[model samples]
Target: MLVISYDLEVFTPPCSPGALTFSAIARLQGNIAPALPYLNAVLPNAVYNPGAPALVWKDGRRHVVFHADHLAVSNLEDRNAAVEQVERLVRLVNETWQERGQIEPSYAVRQRPTPMMLYKLLPGTNCRECGQATCWNFALKLGAGQVTVADCRPLADPIYADRRAQLLASVIEDQFV
Candidate 1:
């Protein structure tokens, strides 16, 4: 296992000390550089920085950064949740390491879809069917991984088929971070 154990430190958000939610950093025992590319290949929306030897991805609303010697996660519910997330990441690293040979490492940089870019493709009907007030709001959530393209029901209309396909290609296909 690339990561057998780690020292976990949980703390309130530095920018908002009074915030109820917390963040955690797991100081890994060993480096997991070898798994970075493998992870980059498998994890959608993962941004791999070969120069930094780090990979950053998202789990729901939580942001996870896998460094050579450590893993940091933010927007956690509690300490236990943080530990669970850390363990999950450790497993991912080990699994990726074991399957590295079969995986083609990706060093190419990928840019996430900007909200404006996403908004441009949306139907712009201000349809509240997506639980959002407007297409722009939906785009914001989509960029944040908080909502899915499927949530925008208007996109399913045949009239928007072309735009929908474009959105799928640029965002949905890479929105699993």
Candidate 2:
């Protein structure tokens, strides 16, 4: 069983043509070029494929990347293993951060904007617990950054594992991860 893994939240922004995310920000500006190789190695299963540039912000740095997608994966199953992998990957990128003379390298510290959250609420059961009437409507709200992930109720349902998974993919973490 795939007991645990990083839970990812994927979403698109309203003003942009592609998606906006937080993870991409950690790659940093000058560090982005060198960091890609490390990210590519760790995220072997997850591909940036057609993901467009995203806006990533931390403390005082705002990374404006034009093409990339934000990915959210499970951090539950085998957290020790997952955290270890992330740590190794971070070390690789931190090397790049050091070359730039940055005092600190921030990783996973900002909230990413994902629009896909609205529909993630959909049990596909069309259960109209939310006034929106449809999950798609909720998704639209989420993409606009108007609706929050907590507003999604069906996510708490045990039967909505898949739905919860989808919801997980559309939220941005609020921490200096």
Candidate 3:
């Protein structure tokens, strides 16, 4: 396994003193730089920087960063959640390393679409079916990785097939695929 041991540190973010969410960092015993490109290839919407030898990804509402020596996860609920997330990340690294041969490593940096860019591709109905106040709000959440394209019910309409196709192809990550 690439990551067999780690030291976990969990704490509330200094920038948000009153916030309830926590963040955690796993100081790994092994260098995970070699597995980054493989992770970049498998994790949809992941941003990889070969120069920094780091990979950034969004797991639901959480922000995760994988460095050569450490893995950091933010926006966790509690200490247990933090620990669980770190463990999950370590497993992900080890699994990716083991399966590297089956996966094609990606070194190219991919930029995530901006909120405005995603908004243009949306149906723009402002229907609030997605529980957001507006289409722009949904777009912002989508771009931030807080919501998926499927959350927008209007996009399921036959009339919006083309726009849905464009959004999924360009902005949204198809996790099922």
Candidate 4:
């Protein structure tokens, strides 16, 4: 076991009986995936999007939400123990989240129309190589933090090297920071 420990504070949408959220949180830890057996079994159409654990700052509330595929720990205590469990779970969740998150951009230059810029920088080959008809469309989704730059096979060239780097850096910053 690690010398230091942590706690996470998680806020989920709404639960149905024993249903947990896709993502979870503990105070010391931010993003940990939740275990949802009831929902997974009951709602087959439920989105099993294993979202990245992130430290979200919104409405003056900093929450760490993780997109979970399943929950493993069944020893979460009510109050104090919950705190310790949250912290430990948070650490583990962060490790897992970091392992599966968006690609990082090369530069830290913030831009509002990033998706558009990415689209413009895209090759626009639409050769179905990137699994999309238009690179612009893909860029739009990428900018909205929906898709990754690697999706564009054409852009995966030496010509778009610099731009690709920048785009990846931006993505990583958003998801990890």
What TM-score fits each model?
0.62, 0.40, 0.64, 0.36
Instruction: For residues 1-177, write the lDDT of model 1, one tens digit per residue.
Output: 788788988888554457666778888898898888889899987877676666777666677778888887766888899889888888889988988889998887666679999999998889699899888899998888787776787786779967766665555333322
Task: Please give the RMSD of candidate 4 to the true structure.
Answer: 16.3
Query: What C-alpha RMSD separates each model from the true structure?
Result: 8.8, 13.3, 8.7, 16.3
lDDT by residue for model 2 over 17-43, one digit each (tens)? Answer: 332222321222232333433333333
* Cα TM-score of candidate 3: 0.64
Model 1, CA-based lDDT: 0.77
Clashing residue pairs in candidate 1, if any? Answer: none
Give the C-alpha lDDT of model 3: 0.80
Evaluation by TM-score, superior candidate among 3 and 4: 3
The per-residue C-alpha lDDT of model 1 at residue 19 equals 61
Model 3, 1-177: lDDT tens per residue?
Answer: 888799999988664577688988899999999999999999987878777667878777677888898888876999999988899889999999999989999998866678898999888879899999999999889887777776887786778867765565443222211
- What is the lDDT for 135 in model 2? 72
By lDDT, is 1 or 3 better?
A: 3
- Shift in Å, residue 111, candidate 2: 20
Model 1 residue runs over 4 Å out of place are: 111-177
